[model samples]
Target: MTFTYQMTVEDAVSFQKELIHHTEEHERRRKVWMKYMRAILIGIGYVGTLFFPYRPESTALHILTAVTVGFLFALLLTPLLNDLYAPYMLRLNRRFLQKSQTWPKETTLQFYETHVEVHSVSTNIHRTTQVPWASIKKVNEDETYRFLYYEEDEALIIPKARQGISEAEQLEIDQTLEKYLSTSPNV
Candidate 1:
């Protein structure tokens, strides 16, 4: 089975955001302290807000209020800041971080019994890569995309929209992945 689709910078940014969100969720799940800390911070902020106008003379309460406000600001602003920064980061990655100047505009994925072949085409170049089933570290899906993670941070992003793929093709791709990936030790 084969699938081809266009990939834009927006797709890259969306993938990055999703990856970051997933990583954050995983960390939040793995680190029990982080969950407790967030709860404690919220509690402090709520309590401090209630007491802030009532008892201005309490030095410890004042300190707690200041700390809580600062922490809350940081927590709230981090995601907003990341949203603003992601596009620039993606641009920088395309221009300097990548080995090739020509980014993949159109990608073709050919799924075989044992491996998958990726063909990426840009204005200046055409590149082909083969990834064995054993090398695929993970397979992830969201509402808009299917991610085949070959490395820890790298993935072949496949859009789930009705671009060119039919339902039958999608099902076939899913079955092929499950067939190979289930047998592979890495995935």
Candidate 2:
């Protein structure tokens, strides 16, 4: 069966936060790169004093030079790295978005069950993919949402609205997930 839906910003944010809570620390490695970028900017400020050939006017230039360099570094590095890892991260993000959109905005989570099949919204490209229930590996519930993990620890979050499923239905899905492996909602 296929379900169609859209998610609001609130739903998306809730799902992202819950998934982040449940995700392995390794999945958040982006923060390490972010910290490295911050450290490099600090280093740039130190070097600017020696190499910028400009006198520091109340440390404002130091701050500006460091910030400009850091902003550029983040802009350059984020795209390049995201591109290199695009396919894998795209899959993960897609899963999360799909799950979050499983139910309609007007629906109460306890009123219905949802099943979905997503086709990427592409304007000029031809592509196709599918994920059957059999492939789902795990289900984890957090304070605000649920993460359905599949394919090598990857996961998708189910927003409360989409979870339009009753707690009983949620448990039913959990039972199904258990057939693939043990299930838990630790996040």
Candidate 3:
């Protein structure tokens, strides 16, 4: 499940907005729950101390305990919170990029996109590789996999389950993206 398309900041922002608007209820619920959990943890740290003060070995120990507990909890929760709010963060980033008039910076995704070919080996090996479309000699997609080629050489192989878009709709979407890439303004 892979797509190759080029887009600018405006397109990215518009796409993000549409995605947010169309996201499933379960995802929204999970995001809300993650926020609640983070708030609860922070509240517990402060509120619990009020109800049951920590009797430190000394003043230094008291300060250390407070800092340690607070920092530890914050460190642990930050990633969790980020994971939960990733979609929202992506939208925010897209919006920021659009506002800043930086198309390239905005359109440059963290993930790589290139023509790829998928292959399977009986040996103990599994990896995804990027192959430029110009170098691609072939391309194939099935219900379960997508294979790309590079001038008689095969490139990346990806499982359908991992594609971000629906399998049923991927082929159509990919074709549309391929068309868009040719005309879309590069960031």
Candidate 4:
């Protein structure tokens, strides 16, 4: 499948939102859970007189406070952490946009069995590259777009409304990517 298109910050913003939704569920939860677990262990060690010069009676109070504060902070800050990611990603992509000016604004994407080929053609820029399926970190789809996250803080955003990319064609592209890329996309 091949599609040709241009990009904008709005496109980048939409993809960033969906990507954050996916990461919050699959990635952030695990990290927060691990931190809480570590806090519990550290609290226990403190109570056991392993590090602090405190009596057994005072150690319990200190452990309880440590555990409470740690768990509460972890639970309360998940959204803040998730929210921070989007703006950071937007900033990074905006920076990428600055660099993108040197390359062609028009992009052609070719999806293959084992890899995807991207070629850009412009007055002064003619760039061609192949990205293997394994390098794609994730795929995401929503009502208006499909994002092929193939690099750190970067994605190939394909608008469903783009010319020549019909509903059926978009579905085919999604399925092809799901099969060849890392895993089934977050639809």
Task: Please tell me which predicted candidate would have the highest lDDT against the true structure.
Answer: 1
Per residue, candidate 2 scores C-alpha lDDT tens digits across 96-181 of: 76675343333221111222234433334433334455556666675656666665445554543344455666566455445544
lDDT (Cα, tens digit) per residue for candidate 3, span 1-187: 4343333454444444333433465367657767677767766664455444547667677656665665567668778676656566566667687676434321111122554333322224443444555564444544544444343333233334432445565556456436423433111
**TM-score-best of 1 and 2:** 1
Clash pairs, model 3 backbone: 116-148, 117-147, 117-148, 117-156, 118-147, 118-148, 118-157
> lDDT values of the candidates?
0.68, 0.51, 0.48, 0.67
Q: Which pairs of residues collide in candidate 4?
A: none
Which residue pairs come into collision in candidate 2?
109-164
Q: Which candidate has the highest TM-score of all?
A: 1
Model 1 whole-model lDDT (C-alpha atoms): 0.68
User: What are the TM-scores, per candidate, against the unseen true structure?
Assistant: 0.58, 0.39, 0.29, 0.50
Q: Against the correct fold, how does model 1 do in TM-score?
A: 0.58
Judged by whole-model lDDT over C-alpha atoms, candidate 3 comes out at: 0.48
Alpha-carbon RMSD of each model: 7.3, 10.3, 15.3, 8.2
lDDT of 1 by residue, 12-122 (tens): 766775565556553454355444545666666666676555656777977677777857954775455445444554565555525554554788989887788989889
Residue 105 in candidate 3 has what lDDT?
24
- Residues 63-132 of candidate 4 have per-residue lDDT tens digits of 6765665556555665665566556666776677656655325778898878888776665878787878
Question: If both were scored by TM-score, which would come out higher, candidate 3 or candidate 4?
Answer: 4
- Between prediction 2 and prediction 4, the one with superior lDDT is 4
Local lDDT at 75 for model 2 = 62
